[model samples]
Target: MGHFKLLDVFAGCGGMTRGFLDDGEFVSVGAVEVDRSAAATYAANFDPTGGHTFAGDIADYTNVPRADLVIGGPPCQGFSALGKRDPEDVRNQLWREFVRVVRESDARMFVFENVDRFAKTPEFELLRTAASNGGELADFRTQVFRLNAADFGTPQKRIRTIIIGSRIGPVVEPPVTHAKNPIGDVLRWVSLRDAFLAGPVVLEPGVRDEWFPESTADFQNFQVPGPFKLRDLHVTRRYDLTSEIRYAHIAPGKSRLQLPVELQYPCWRKNPAGASDVLGRLRWDQPAVTIRTEFFKPEKGRFLHPQWENGGEQVNRALTHAEAAVVQGFDERHVWHGTKAEIARQIGNAVPPPLARAVAGVVADRLQAG
Candidate 1:
């Protein structure tokens, strides 16, 4: 009975569920996700029987089971900083469904996650107003929190909006367990260099740090340890000679802005001052930037492998799937059930398990105390 049951609404491939499971204090009762491929992936890993899962729009789902905690968020495309931030985007209205399910589930508490920009949007205010105006969500007094994935253990700096609401009483917030260059017991922010859980690689701001176990050959040849092995996910990509030269121009810790005039994309050459992250390369000694849906493409974000200024074997490639999974907080043991693109999207959209585990711990403690 102490094992709190969980209902994961809008669950995206069980990222949040993974956290709760990792916390060892909760059990999944059900999960709902729109993308059938994603839902299949979630079910394969978390709901193999398919009896407690729904793979459709939240509006059409009515099998809300009673649980101690309900966690999820609507699609955040509208509020994502990577998008146009269109207030009129239909996805913005999905929060209404979240509120509806929360009301029906009769859960003691709920956690909502979204892009950081969601906190500032009009839709957020609408949800807040429902809580304040004695609407369906009124019984659940809500508070908003901001959390970063790196602070919770993931090797990427993915910041997100977290809103915790409870009908049982006020909910406690999350804890920050890591920091930049942490001193004593707290861990330093993990960087790409430490993605494999390698030894401490901290260095002065501009100093170029070499990979750990200097005897190891190179980034591409290295295998992800057994503990982090992923099934059915590969990050191998082919590149043309011209693209390779463009990547070479993107030195470690740098971007397409460093490319010479000819190497720059036509659009990039015209808009030199636009995005600095385009065609970017990652730094070995620092946490990665957010891994967006198209992380396989270096032109999309900082998805490139680090290279010495003098050049190396990995200079022309992007992060491998194992590398991206570890940095994004995923274990390879869970079998996947989607196309490569869908799987990539799931990884990009997931709430890092480490962060989710931290939040789940806080909630479980509060429920136990009560």
Candidate 2:
């Protein structure tokens, strides 16, 4: 079959496109990313010539080059539970640009990704209704799927809403290859210990990031050329002894609630039932919770490394950038560019390549049938 040409809009370090290319079925024709650093990161790996990469507003994308498919949607920060959920947030309606791209590109298919809460927003309702009739998306048959990254083999359980529109045929949810409860051939979810613990971690930077001639497995989901070294591997924070004591008090899979009243912060004790995962230690045997942009800060979520709370190696630090990147399904080959904070944002905002690869399979089947 002929390879499909792809256009990625609002592309964050080309995560979704990376998955598509990895599937060996699609090649990106052009990509639009407003963030200069992110676009640079995407280019660092895929578009070195600066050709076919657009690092500007999507609204200026007139006369879009024709492609077989379009992927990516503006992030749903406005609709995210973490956000203010402001009805007047301009970002909420940027889906219009996504629709415009699909229509103008005249692509046979498109895939839109967003936070799970986006489906509950009125904006999503508008998009859904328009896709069905009386709009540019009328030619396409659209389906909504709520997918968890862990279900598709990612070590992190990130639940995102996927909207697939195909002019050719109905789109189905990608089959889950991994499950918490394995039934028959389905494998169990990949555990953090399996993905992050086997390697020799450097507390500081390495001389250089080693790139082998071919793929090698350090982690099952993401294999980099070398082990975790400086760049992100050593991107750790220095929590004082007092804070260390607090983390030590929380056992694996446990949170601040475990701290005695005297040790607990007043807020934690006051709302014992609230934010159960705040200042929580990660469980070595389980899939990770969603890795947010500020994963470097342990107080934000359950990001602490699986240190022996009572005894063993002093793994008291939070998940380093390398571990979090791998858990997000970005292989070692995935090049990232930007400041420490910028890199973290790009990683946190990205789609897990494993999940996107599964979606690619679904899109490929539809395109082939059409």
Candidate 3:
């Protein structure tokens, strides 16, 4: 069977695009992205023909070519748990553009991804109705499901909502391909310990590039290689004396809730029950919390290492870019460009590639069977 052509919308650093292509059953024909950093990252990894990766707003994008499949995860900040779910956020309207492209592209199948909370919004139903009643997707069957990356072997418990549409057959959700740390039928969830090993490992520039090479072949088969350690990493951010002293009291899996009365921040002290993850440390035995953009800062959430002893010093630091990438289901070979913040945003905003691969596998099976 010929490879299915894929058009990726809101293709931030080509996570979904890479995921689909990694299966070796789909080829990305075009991608639309507005962020230059992300767009550059996309170009670095994908070899889309005709330079079809538009590094601009989707609103201005036109003359899009039809494809066999359309896949994307639009800007989900509006529906995310981190921010105010303001109904008036402009990013919310991007879904309309997604539908417009899907309709115009006349793709046989489409996969739309977003935060799990997106399902509760009125637009969820609106988009479904629009896709079902109008344009090329008029007869397309649609299914909406909330899926966890952990279910597909990612070491982070990032939950996302995926909406699938298919005219070829009923859109079926991908089966859970991996159980957590499997020990003979007792399927335990994949833990942070499973994704990254303890590392005081320093990453030299040449070694980092070698591990995460720029070839699609490398990216496709990318793993940490033998004796896996974090690379393409970030320096541990230093904390102020007061913050350091406070953090010293927290243990693995514990947060400010266990801090001494004097160590609690004023806001947390006033509302002791609030912001449960502040100053929290992750448990090595469990999967990580969702790898948010702010995961580099230990104060942001439970981003701290469980117990990484660095050169005989007991240091608690947040996940490095490489560690966070692995936790998000990206292999060591997936490279990112630009500032640390820009790279973190790209990684955080992405659908776990393994999760995307699972979805793409189902779509590919249906398309091939036809």
Candidate 4:
């Protein structure tokens, strides 16, 4: 196969770029991102040797390197299913710029990704119009597919929409190689345990002063028994604890029926607003729920530590930045450069590398066949 070049837009921390680069057929030429922190992180990781980094608004930029493929995921917050479904949200209009760049570039193929809700939005209608006038109708064809990360072998159960446009005939969707395993099976089936085995548990000194204190008297109130089990802790003490609990009906090596709810967490039904707001725990054997930018903010979703207790005084923190990266299919060796919060946002907003790899593989195959 001939060498192919790629330009990534709205590329948060180079998730898609990393995937494409991994295939050995494509090279990441450049990327555009808006958030200064996220842009910095993407540059640090993707262009560590110093390459073009566009920190400004993508809409204002016109000149960019022409490549064989242009790939990007516009910010989908305005069109996300979880937020206010305002059709007029200005952020939804960013898709037009993505289409604009791809249409003008020399690239023969483009991939646009967004939340599944994008399919139902008026923005989609706008996309269709733009594609028609942008010359997609005459020279290129487009198809959209709603994909779940679990179906592609990532342990996380995340569903996203991917739109592919190519100048060369119809774009065929990639077939699912991994079968769907229950949440429990996915967790136990991976080798990440060794990959993430507790590193030096460094508490940020700043976070310590904010959430804990050096004074023994102040710390005493938060102290609990060492190595206490999550089931032993009460629910009232932890404000972040959810009420939803998962009982193990089936044990490892046993039939699914053997699992049952062994214990209930206190905050299970307290919050009615979102699924992650209630008490919940992770099954050791299954894939994790979607890792969101709000993973650090337990109030935003059900990101509770699998071992956190309801009322336990122990520090049951949200998933660390490194842990979130692994669950999203990034290698443990992949360096993330930013504050925990900044890295979390990048991970939350990124396209899972594994999914991108699958798409890139298909594109590579098409180019090879052509």
Provide the TM-score for each candidate, comma-separated: 0.86, 0.87, 0.84, 0.72
Per-residue alpha-carbon lDDT of candidate 4 for residues 239-282, written as tens digits (9 for 90 to 100): 32232223222122222122233332234334223353432334
- For all candidates in order, the CA lDDT equals 0.75, 0.77, 0.73, 0.60
| Candidate scoring better on TM-score of 2 and 3 | 2
Compose the digit string of candidate 3's lDDT tens values, residues 1-370.
2379899999997778767887889988888888876776776667523277787899888978889899988877644344434556566568778878887888888999988888876667666776666643577888888898888877888889999888888756787855665555545677776666632333221211312223222222232111222354544565678877776677877887888988877787788788889878887778898988888788789887766333444455666677677778777556565566777798888888988988988889988976
- Which regions in candidate 2 have their CA more than 4 angstroms from the true location? 80-89, 198-232
Could you tell me which 10 consecutive residues in candidate 4 have the lowest summed lDDT?
228-237
**Model 1 C-alpha lDDT versus the unseen true structure:** 0.75
Error of 2 at 362 (Å): 0.9
lDDT, candidate 1, 207-288, per-residue tens: 2212211111111222221211253244456778999888877787788889889877788767779988888898888889
Off by over 4 Å in 1: 79-89, 197-231, 309-311
**Better candidate by lDDT, 2 or 3:** 2
Clashes by residue pair, model 1? 230-332
* Count of clashes, each model: 1, 2, 1, 27
Best by TM-score: 2
Question: Model 3: which residue pairs collide?
Answer: 180-188
C-alpha RMSD in Å of predicted model 1 compared with the true structure: 7.8
